[model samples]
Target chain A: MKAIYKREVQSYFNSMIGWMFTAALTAFIGIYFMAYNLFQGDAYFSTALGATLFVLMVLVPILTMRSMAEERRSRTDQLLLTAPASVTAVVMGKYLAMLTVLACPLAIACLCPLIIHFNGTAFLLSDYASILAFFLLGAAEIAVGLLISALTESQVLSAVGTFGLLLVLYLWDGLVAYLPSTAGGSLAGLLVILALVCFLVNALSSNWKVTAAVFVAGAAAIIGGYIAASDRFAGLLPDMLGRFSLLGAFDSFSVDHVFDVRGILLYLSLIALLVFLTVQVVQKRRWN
Target chain B: MIEVKNLVKRYGNHCAVDHLSFTVEDGQVFGLLGPNGAGKSTTMNIMTGYLAATEGDVLIQGHNILEEPEAARKCVGYLPEIPPLYPDMTVLEYLRFCAELKKLPAERRKEDLDEVLSLTHLNGQAERLIRNLSKGYRQRVGLAQAILGFPPIIILDEPTVGLDPKQVVEIRSLIRHLAKEHTVLLSSHILSEIRAMCDHVLILRKGKVMACDTPEALEEKLSAGGALELSVRGSAEAVRSTVLTVDGITSCEAQQEGDTVKMMISADGDAREALFYAFAQARQPILEMRPKTATLEEVFLDLTDEDDAVAAQAAALLADTPDEAAVQTTDAEQEGTGDESDL
Candidate 1:
């Protein structure tokens, strides 16, 4: 695991991808720092951190698109897999290498708050918390990119798929508002979502008996809950899912200046889940 | 030592390897010989713990490859069909990384890398990126990696496919050298290499083990000693009748060669003395007569067909002699163990 990690990190920085990724993020964040704090004389460093979140969605896929996909394409995965290393160790080693690459620009991001202190009065405590949140968010995003990269052989497909998913995540709040708001519409939407979930479960497990049971049980639960408390159904669809939204949770530090532990839990779990899924994808490929 | 028992691999409905079983004794050069798309690589993969066997198990040095892959793999080194190399790294760096991955002691890594490089003749190319090396050099680098850790068993799948003739000889010689200490199981579709290098050859066709034995034993077992050539000066019928009088001689036919009669005898044994005495007594001056035995090429052709039933029939066609005498029959008549057809 250490060997793979060292080799992956060295190769990333040895090529143009590492420098290019760091430079692109630094340049974008610096531009935002200038616009949000320096030129405008704003005291909060977190606003600029908020502006950089959108940029991370595009830049992350570039940095991580080739992580696992290139190994599959080059057939180098054979060496690592056939070695004594377990699949989890190999996946985590590469993931940590990507996170290490991400850490460089983030180390630069840490200086923005200090620069604010020199120029004017700075909200140092909130600023540092927001930076921690920003780094965690970026780590979560990179994990998502790594998982997508592992699922596909084509780098182009991995990059495009990650970018598409991240774009939706960035617009997750706005997209939720567009969902049906009326009680009947919300109930119908709930059923459709459950059906889609059941469909995905069926596709993954390929077990029709369990899928049908879940399909029936899920329909009963949704209908039973709606009838017991009609008001709970009102706008509850968007609100429940919205609470789990990753980009929306960043709004606590960026928009409201509140540290949400619940949001942090959501991001960490999602990151762990995606990393596990990446390992599963790689394992499934060996069998197939 | 590696023991593979009743190994079966099927892709959907088509069986790729069909209940094949063989054992590799320690310190022997075992070759899996077959044509294109034969299960030589598949068998190697299963033995190396690369691919899981569908219906059977591989035990490497007493550890089941699937149940105890790490323990089993610890005793084996594998070079796959293609060298799984990182093109971006220099040869030395790539090998160092492989050494570390193989869990070699850090204190010994540098020495081990140097040893592997020297063994594969990659010392001069150590500083070069793997992408820039020639085909033979890249193959050597791959073999160098396989030889790392110095495991007890080494499995190489087509280790010399992309190499030139000279490099092929070098690799074959290296395989021979390794066989002195480690159990080496290598595969090749090239028959001559297997014949020249291997102590035991497992001939596979359509995922089945056709025959497995020493190269000498296989050729002799399929001896077709009925056909012979004779030289005599007489009428064709005169020579044929003289040759037919010999005991154990089945049939005789003669063709003319200038002033001499060229006779081919279908005999159960060496009819040299019988033909000579018979021709002299019949007033037909005799010359040369020799029985023909099947070559390795014929043995290969007659043993391993893509369709098992066809190969079984071809094998039966050549197995006229009883089992015990057959192996010695070709050896006694053909003095050299080397191919008789070439002679």
Candidate 2:
């Protein structure tokens, strides 16, 4: 694992991707910090983090585009797979290496709060906490990019696909706001989401019985609940999806001045889930 | 030692390896000889724990490849058809990375890396990026990677495919050198290459083992009904009539090649003496006499009922000493069993 991590880190530094990512991320964050705190005389540095969230949609994919896709394209994954190392070790090693590369810029951003404090009144703890959340958020997105990169051998396609998904995530709240709020519409939306989940479950476990059971149970529950209490279902889905807006969870740290434990857990779990999918994606390639 | 038992690898409905079973002893250059599209690479992949077998198991040094792959892989180093190289890395970094991937101890990694660099003749180009190296150099780097740590078994798939003649010879000699200390299973489509290097050859066609034995034994089997080419200085009609009139002669064909008659003659018994007597009676000078030898193509054809069956049969039309073998029955039996399935 350490061997893979060392190689991945070295590879990042050897090429331009590492420097490009750092330069782009630091420049963007620096510009935002200057404009927001310096010109606007913003008291809270967390506002700069809130502004910088938009930059992650582009920067994270560039940082992670070649992580697994290039290995598959060049057939070097065969070398890694045929080695004595386990798949988990390989995944974690690469993921940690990407995280470390992501860290170089995040490390530079740590000084932003000190700079703001010198210039004016800066809430250091809130600012640092938001930075922590921002870093964890980037970690989660890097994992997502890793999984996306593993799904295809074309680095360009991987980058484009990850960029698309991150864009959707950025526009997540507005996307959910457009959801229909009628009980029937919500019911239909719930059923569609349940059906998609069942599809995923079926694809993964190859067990039709459990998938069918979930679909049946979910249908019965949704219909029964809707029929019993129509008012309770109104506007429920959009509200729930808005709560699930991954970046929306971070709103408390930046906008509400609250350390969101649930948000941190969500980011960590998402990271775990993405890493697991990356492993599955890699294993599936061998089978094919 | 490695044992592959009843290995079957199928892609959906297409079976690449029907049921390949073979064994390599502690020290031997075992060759998997086959044509293109044969299952040699698939079998090698399964044996080295790269591809999982569809219906069988590979045991490397008593460890099952499927169940205990890391343990099994520990005993083997594989060079796939295309050497998996990192183009961005320098040769030195690539070697160092491979050494680390093998979990070679830090204390010994420098020495081991140096050893492989020397063995593969990669010393001069050690610091060059792999992308800039020539194809032959890339192949040698791959060979060095596979031979690292001195694993007990090294499986190379077409190791000499892109090499020049000199590099092929060097790699062959290096493989032979590896055979002294480790088991080697190398696959190739070239008959003479296998015939020259392999201690034992496993001939495969359409995933079936057609024949496996030492080259000498294979030659001796196809050499049973020997045919002789005789160039006699006489009229074609007269020479043919005299050869036909011999008592033990089974069949004969005579053709004139520039004032000399070339007669392909076969007899029911050792008829060289009978033909000589007949020729002596006719007073025709037997200018040149040479026995025809069967190459491996004839051997493969004779076994597989392939395209060369007619040619082999026409060549083998000479009847006489049906059992003029080059070895004893036990020698053939030992060699045949060594190649049969999982010896």
Candidate 3:
């Protein structure tokens, strides 16, 4: 794991991706910092960070585009896979290396809050906590990019796919808002979501029995609950999906100044899930 | 020691390796000889723990590859068909990373690294990025990577594919040198290359083992399907009729040139003594008689070619040889036991 981590980190710098990512992100964040805090005289540095989230949606993919995809494209994964290292170690080493690259700008961003404190009244604790949330948000997106990279051998496709998913994540709240709000509409929406979940389960485990059971059970519960208390079903689907908005979790930190412990847990769980999925994807490739 | 037991790898509906099995003993160089798309690379990949076998096990030093991958992989170093190299890294950096990835002890890391660098003759290119190195140099870097830490088993898939003749010889010599200390298994489509390097060769055709034995043994079996050419001063019909009387002579073709008849005889076994007396009795002057032996190249082509009738006939004739017949009986016994275990 250490060997992979060291090699990945070195490769990142040896090429232009690391420097380009750092410079691009820091430049965007600096513009936001200058516009919000310096020109607008804002006291809370989190507002500047909130505006820079879009910048991450674009730049994080570039930082992680080549992580696993390039290794597979060039057949370098053969070396890593045939070594004594386990798949988990190989994936973690790469994840941590990308995290290290993401940390570079964040490390520089750490000084932004300090600068604000020197200029005027600064919410140091809130700003630092928001910075932590911002870093976790980037880490989670990096995980998403890593998984996308593992899914394909084309680096361009990985970057584009990751950017598309991150775009959807950024607009997640708006997308959920479009969900049906009436009781009947919510019931139908829940059934569709359940079918999608069952499809995922079927694709992953390839066991029709389990997938059928889950689908039947979920449909029965949704219909029965709707019939029992129709009012409880109103606006449930949107509300459920709205809770999963990744940017919403970040808003709790950068916009509302709340620690949002659940939000932190959400990012942590997403990272873990994506990393596990990446490992499984790589393992499945070997079998294929 | 490396033992591949009934290994099978299928890509969707296409079976790449079909019930293939072989074992490499300690301190020997084993070769997998096959044409392109014969599952040579796939088998090596499975043996090195890169690809999971569809329906078999690979044991490296008694460690099952799928069940105990790390233990099994630790014992073998594999150079895949394409040497897995990182272009961004210098040769030295890449090799060092491999040494660390192989989990060499810290105390032995530097010593082993130096030794591998010198062994592959990568000392001059150590500081150069792999991106700038030529194909042969990159191959050396890969060879050095595999030879690092001196694992007991090293598996190379087409190690000399892209090398020049001089570099091919050098790499072949390097492989030979490594075999002095490590058990080496390499695959190639080049017949002479295998003949030159392998102590034992496994010929594969369409994912199945066509034959597995020492190179000389394989050639000797084909040689048993012997043919002979004779020049005699006689009519074509007379020479043909006399040669036909010999025991074990399958066919005799005679062509008359002026007063001399040239006859080519295909036989199941040695028919020289029988033909000599028959010609003498017929009062035909025998000017020349030469026995034709099959070379290894002919053996390879005959065994791997789609036409199996000729190979089967040769094998049947080989079964008549007393010493070779004993080996076949034992092989049959081993197959019987293998079937019993499957049951």
Best by lDDT: 3
What lDDT tens digits, residue by residue, belong to model 3 across residues A1-288?
999999999988889999999998899889999999999999888999999999998998898889999999999899999999999999999999999998999899999989998987999999999989999999999999999999999999999999999999999999998888999999999999999999978866668999999999999999999999999998898998888889999999988899999999999999999999899889877787
In model 2, how large is the Cα lDDT of residue B211? 69
Query: What are the Cα lDDT values of the candidates?
Result: 0.82, 0.82, 0.87
For each candidate in turn, the TM-score is 0.90, 0.90, 0.89
Question: Which residue pairs show collisions in model 1?
Answer: B232-B261
Lowest lDDT sum, 10 consecutive residues, model 1 chain B, at: B334-343
Candidate achieving higher lDDT, 2 or 3: 3
Tens-place lDDT per residue, model 3, B1-343, is 9888999899889999999988899998999988788899999988988888889989999999989999999999989988999998899899989999999998999999899999898888889999999999989898998888999999999899889999999999999999899999999998889999999999887798878889998767655245787899989988888888878887777899999998878777678888899999999989999975556776666555544554454345344673344334323322222211211
Residues A66-172, candidate 1: write the lDDT tens digits. 99999998877878877877789999999999888898998998899999999879988888888878888988999989999998889999999999988888888
User: CA shift at B66, candidate 1, in angstroms?
Assistant: 2.7
Question: What is the DockQ for all candidates, taken in turn?
Answer: 0.60, 0.60, 0.82
Q: How well is candidate 1 docked (DockQ)?
A: 0.60
Q: Evaluate fnat for each of the predicted models and list the values in order.
A: 0.47, 0.56, 0.92
lDDT value, residue B218 of candidate 2: 71
Q: What's the ranking of the predictions by DockQ, best on top?
A: 3, 1, 2
Model 3, residue A214: displacement in angstroms?
Answer: 3.2
Displacement of the residue A211 alpha carbon in candidate 3, Å: 2.8
